[model samples]
Target: MKSNRYIMILFFIVTLLNSSCSDTFVDDIDLKFCGKCAHTGRWTVDSLDFNPCFSTQAECLDWAKKNGYSDRGCVLCN
Candidate 1:
């Protein structure tokens, strides 16, 4: 009887922990939530190469500049 009670308690604890670890709003957050944006691959100029995802126009622009891409090459839409 005592062993059965302990088993049930352990089962309940495991179930609760598993369920609590999950969230209803747990989802992939869209890094690009700002104005018009494009993948880093699109921002190519001269011989520079970029391969990354962005969540803001500024970040893309910054990377582009560092990689030799021009602001004109980037399009931002809000």
Candidate 2:
């Protein structure tokens, strides 16, 4: 009986640990919420090779200037 109780306790602890280690969120919020105001990888803004970077006009401009890029316009909604 004592051994059975210890086994049950171990099982409970293992279950709890497994559940806590999961990367999945417990809430129902949309994944988009993580990047709501952030850049969405749309619009290239320069002569430089671009990747998904800024989420705002200002950010794009700053990036262009820092990298010596000469173009500053929206590419496509990424």
Candidate 3:
């Protein structure tokens, strides 16, 4: 019957809409963007220890000290 075809078309349209709607959803994401950088003399020994991209040099140093790093020097970079 024509009603059965109409129902099938509606179901197909609904399925397509549901599948396409998933693209607009976003999952949990943590992002940090600090316009400055920090550097210590430890980069020569270990490149991974040389973490930069901080809001300020002092903040970077504090993080280093808390993590038991001997970062006695700091310099901000762009």
Candidate 4:
């Protein structure tokens, strides 16, 4: 009986660890640009606008350049 209890506990622990390690958010990794922002002053996963709209930092910077926001890049909104 003790062995069975131990096995159950082990199974529960394994299941918990697996769930914790799994990615629960978006599958595709999204990046955000924070040019000249106080947050990071660069590209990052976290955004002040809470908008992770670009797939790559280059794309985000491109948008910024095209939209006349090269100096203070705009956050790509979703």
Clashes of each: 2, 3, 0, 0
> What's model 2's lDDT at 31?
34
- Where is the poorest 10-residue window by lDDT in model 4? 43-52
Q: Pick the candidate with the highest lDDT.
A: 4
Q: Tally clashing residue pairs in candidate 2.
A: 3
In order, what lDDT does every prediction score?
0.52, 0.56, 0.51, 0.57
List the candidate 4 regions with Cα displacement exceeding 4 Å. 23-78
Cα shift from native, residue 50, model 3 (Å)? 4.0
> What's the lDDT for residue 55 in model 4?
56
**Selected candidate, larger TM-score, 2 vs 3:** 2
Writing each residue's lDDT as its tens digit, candidate 3 over 1-78 gives 999999999999999988877643544342222222323222121124445544555665776677665544444442
TM-score of 1: 0.29
lDDT of 1 by residue, 1-78 (tens): 999999999999999989887665466443332222243333222222334445555776787678656643444322
> Per-residue lDDT tens digits of candidate 2, residues 9-41?
999999999988755554643333213223455
Which rank order by lDDT, best down to worst? Answer: 4, 2, 1, 3
Q: Is candidate 1 or candidate 2 better by TM-score?
A: 2
Displacement of residue 49 (Cα, Å) in model 1 is 30
User: Which window of ten consecutive residues has the lowest lDDT sum in model 2?
Assistant: 29-38
Model 1 weakest lDDT span, ten residues long? 39-48
Error of 1 at 69 (Å): 27
